[model samples]
Target: MTKEIFDDIFGKGNSNWQKVSFLRRCFFNDNGITVNWRANTPLIKLWKQAKDLDEFKVLLKKDKDAQKLQFTHEWLKTADKDYDQYLASIIKETATMQYDVWSDAGSVKVGNAQFSFLISHNNGDGHAIAAVFKNEKDFISSPMKFITSVEGTFNIYDYDCGQNVIVTLNGRYDVYVYCGITCFVKK
Candidate 1:
């Protein structure tokens, strides 16, 4: 029975026997209070919280934990892209020697770059072309592996001019010569 009903039944008189007990009426009671209570109050108090600038400053002390990098590869890919762009910029700096139009016999001396390339008619041996990319393994070098002869993809690891190609990061500035196969890059 509720305290109100009990009090109504037996008036609020200090008649000892009429002093009703305030026992737990609700099932989930802490102290005669409902345990399964739900308040309409929201979690965020819009404007009621007191702002303490000084106390906040005191509490917001500098963090002691080092700012460790989390999964640096995510941004590392960005760095890779940046380095790739830088390498591409350097490749552009040297200017591509792509000036092939049709199978013909000729040699080109790249301006101020000390690079030499030739396309010659092997008479009957299909084709025989070679380029002397000096000090230029970045563009062409000595591990000079060929990825594909048909596609004209090639790689070199050393330089005749003692220059380092694919330095710092590998496969940055890819160099290939589509010999005697007219692969001209229009500026």
Candidate 2:
């Protein structure tokens, strides 16, 4: 499709027209027949509002979302139906079917300070663990460190003074604070 035709349907300078044009080329081959087809007003509006290809695909999948757009050509309608089915299959294949549940052990107190812990699975080889201090006072203990019992696995820690401390650990680890307080872990 030419830029002139795209501009006519979706107004000038639309960022998504190139992507839409590419997808149209993949789905529809009848350029001559498409030339005679009028712009579906509701569809044009929806296309203009779509921020990206992903959002446009989502809009196309929802019947209620594109209910106002009337398909004027048989081939255009067929292409849209095929694209929707393709999206559904791809979504099903890539969907996250299971999630890891981490048990919480509340906060641990170390001397005058208390810390709340959170652990997130990285979906790969490691987990990101964060320890947030409950109070606004910095841990005055110099050279604060996170000690884990797992041999050969080291902790990469980032401390934001009195705010929070983050550590990335590989595999299963039992982490403890420098003050001998055990942090929460996945149960």
Candidate 3:
């Protein structure tokens, strides 16, 4: 419910969470396969006008020689060190693919989601969170109605927090999410 986990915002119109929570955290810039961060200032434009995943990848890979490329270490070489990691981290998050069904590992789907998470007790034993919505699955199943599946991580929350997440998908035209402590665990 807290978007403060990674200091990244989590709410309507937010898209970065889907990438990392669904796939892996190590994202790429030149392509969305590694991450899909939208620069505070927009970056290179994707060609082919892809709306779907496959098309987006083709678009993301296009026009490689157009601008300066960045890497984790390379970006750090510049004046700002922290910002470089932050930028690269967001990029790496974009590379992950989306899917459904919860698998033990090696898959993008979390059933709900399984974005790679890291936890810290520096604040307290109780966990803190910061999540991002990645995708949604709608159908006529027992679950019924809208089923949104997001992909975000808790760099500061408990590693188990993602598992305990009890998600309730709200029906809305555009992307919608409800966050907050629905319940607390006494551990």
Q: On a 0 to 100 scale, what is the lDDT of residue 168 in model 2? A: 32
Q: What are the models' TM-scores?
A: 0.17, 0.21, 0.18
Candidate 3 residue-wise lDDT at 83: 38
Candidate 2's residue-wise lDDT over 61-150, tens digit each? 464424322231222333454543343232233222211122222222111123333322222222222332222121111112344334
lDDT score of residue 173 within candidate 2? 38
Q: Tens digits of per-residue lDDT for model 3 on 41-83?
A: 1122332233443443333333333112332223223324343
- In model 3, what is the error at residue 176, expressed in angstroms? 21
TM-score of decoy 3 = 0.18
What RMSD, rounded to one decimal, does every model reach?
29.0, 18.6, 18.8
**Clash number for model 2?**
0
Task: Write model 1 residue lDDT over 54-116, tens digit each, in one string.
Answer: 322222221111011111112222224342233233333433332212222332212112332
Worst 10 residues of 2 by lDDT: 134-143
Candidate with top TM-score is 2
The alpha-carbon deviation from the true structure for residue 173 of candidate 1, after best TM-score superposition, in angstroms, is: 16
Better by lDDT, candidate 3 or 1 = 3
lDDT of each: 0.26, 0.34, 0.27
Give lDDT for model 2.
Answer: 0.34
Query: Among all windows of ten consecutive residues in candidate 1, which has the lowest summed lDDT?
Result: 62-71
Candidate 1 local Cα displacement, residue 120, angstroms: 25
- Give the local distance difference test score of model 3: 0.27
